[model samples]
Target chain A: MKQQRDSIPELVWNGNISVEIHQKENSLTYLANLPRHSYFAQILEDLKRLFAPKVALEECWLSSGKASIKWHWPVGVLYDLLSQEDPESATSVPVLWHLVFHVGSFPSSLVVPMGSMETFRTCFFNALKESDYVRNGSSSLVIALSKPETDTYWNSLLNHDFYDYRPIATKLFTSKSRIIPLKIYLGADAPIVQSSASLGYTLGQVLHKQLPRLFPSAVMYSLLKPVLHGIVLPSTVSTDIMNRDFCYPDGFLHIVLIPIST
Target chain B: MASSINAVEDQLSKTLESLQTEEKSSSLQEKIDEIISSYNEKENRKVNLRFKAIGRTPLLRKNVFAINASHRFDKVIRFLKKELGFKPDSSLLLYVNYCFAPAPDEIIGNLYDNFSVDGYLLIYYCVNVAFG
Candidate 1:
């Protein structure tokens, strides 16, 4: 049975446990004061320094089995979480935080190993291509790279640079794990383009929405259908196309976009 | 006493050797052959699909349909569209096991064999707004 979204209290919780990332010039100011000696606080303290001036996660709190992260600008937190050396060995915080974005709800407080983002992206792309939504060779891909608002260099780039220089052209794509604000141009020369923000907030959304727009509406019957399905992803599955280690247990991740009634 | 211990040790060693060689080891080629044959056999089999409407959607009069295992999932989607009188442009989402949406090109046999709950592959279909 489909659990109503509001019924899942853990997902909807607005408790004391919260993370507030205030964007500052050249650095993000984090403002969470977890207990000094606690293990959760230590994890946050270590992660807080990762992005420094480029992207900062300010006051972060983990309490009552719920965590909240707030950031106005796009950052690579999702990429960092999955690309870590040993995700299975990582403590609960990073894994849960990653899950919060993928699935609108968290099935449990325990942070189990979800596979690397690379594997997820590959599996997703393979599935999409197989379904004929995405094609290669003739597909012109424009990966729009934008500096996170927290980066000091962000203000230096003019709007013309955004239009003229492909982020990849500027050599921003040195690493695979870093979030590449992708603008997928479907055809060899299709011109419909959307920025990183307006194309659905998450990476999954961009794949479904913007990518399909590249195709003729009459030719492509289904728009960006989710490469990964369900309201929640499972921890493991023997039958998933990706490596078994990366499979969600079953119903632990949701990729579908449903309209919310206000 | 020493002679008796020696005799028993010799007997145990002989038994162990015989047990070790009782089973013949298959080569890598033989293992590969076996996997290919089993896969081919499974691919040739036919399967039944059971479709059920979810939410406020109208009920399908006849729920069960039979399809070849080798057929692509697109066939099933096309059939549903015709049966439900859905326009070609209208959106329909089909989920296998009521969990994940299988790609249209995915084989029906593979889905039926792996995810079928009660001898029938259950596909839950929902009419959704195409863009949302």
Candidate 2:
């Protein structure tokens, strides 16, 4: 009986595994029917396989009484992996590089967390400064304010507009331009407004009649104008409106019309 | 001399009968050839000719029309019928290359350029015509 007991593998009481260093408390816990040493070895092996063998595990600790283990790995390995898979994951990956390499033309709108616009703009400008395309005069950058802080900013820029600032590839970037109104709905529990369906219907009607006249010069106007001209009320808006019991659907609408440089 | 004359008459009759049969067969063959040539010409023309109707204009040109997601056939069909006063025939076969074959009622967006249609990356949408 003693010999049989000794021959059997000792059980390892492993607790939590947290991938993100920031979320150590809410880690995933697991119990493997293997010895403590072997369990640690398995984890190390898994890490080694996931990251290359060049990824060195710094430290690993097993709790005294609790079935928990804590480990730390290099941040460089994580950054490289994240950048390769998810371009938007890290703030360091230049957005212009992605725009140049991946998407040839600029998108109509880039939705980000509401408060992070400044940070995003700064990073975008920095990237443009470093990029070879901009340096070599292949492309130019222009920033137009939707609303000038004061008349002074506009007046100053307007004085030397031809000399100091010039249009890029016949494309103008300005926020002051009027956009087609889009109605968005938020649901009660959902992130969007609930009444967006009605808004979308109304917008669709207006656009169906008006779009052809608006974009007559566009080659695929018949196909694209009607769909794009109307206001979009996504389901996300529906949920938010319902949850908040917001009556003024029009107030929540965001209408920004801007031209993009190709 | 009498036997020779009789034999000559018999040979002449056989030759006349054969000539009549040959004339009928030749006429039938000529008709068949005409039909076959007509069909071949139609097939060739259908393969070569195409047509396109631009915008709300009532004019349709004898030009090839290629279809792409960018062309938005579903949206264009509605516009063409309702606004442009053009109706597609029921027999109008909608063909896309294996790469460009879009699903029925697929709402195409700007992102279509990123992907392929049928099997070929959708460069353009063209229409071919065959008149019998």
Q: Best by lDDT, which number?
A: 1
lDDT of 1 at B56: 63
Q: Candidate 1 overall Cα lDDT vs. reference? A: 0.35
- Residues A118-199, candidate 2: write the lDDT tens digits: 3323323222221211112211222232233223322322232222222221122211222212221111111110011122
lDDT of every model, 2 decimals:
0.35, 0.25
lDDT for each residue of candidate 2 in B40-69, tens digit (9 for 90 to 100): 222221111122332333443333333433
Q: After superposition, how far is residue A239 of candidate 2 from its true place, in Å?
A: 21
Off by over 4 Å in 2: A1-119, A122-178, A181-262, B1-132
Candidate 1's TM-score reads 0.29
Model 1 lDDT at residue A187: 16
| Candidate with the greatest TM-score versus the true structure | 1
- RMSD of every candidate to native, in Å, equals 25.1, 31.5
Model 2 global lDDT (CA atoms, 0 to 1): 0.25
Model 1 C-alpha lDDT per residue in residues A72-145, reported as the tens digit of each score: 10112212222221222324252222212222232222221122333223333233222211111111121122
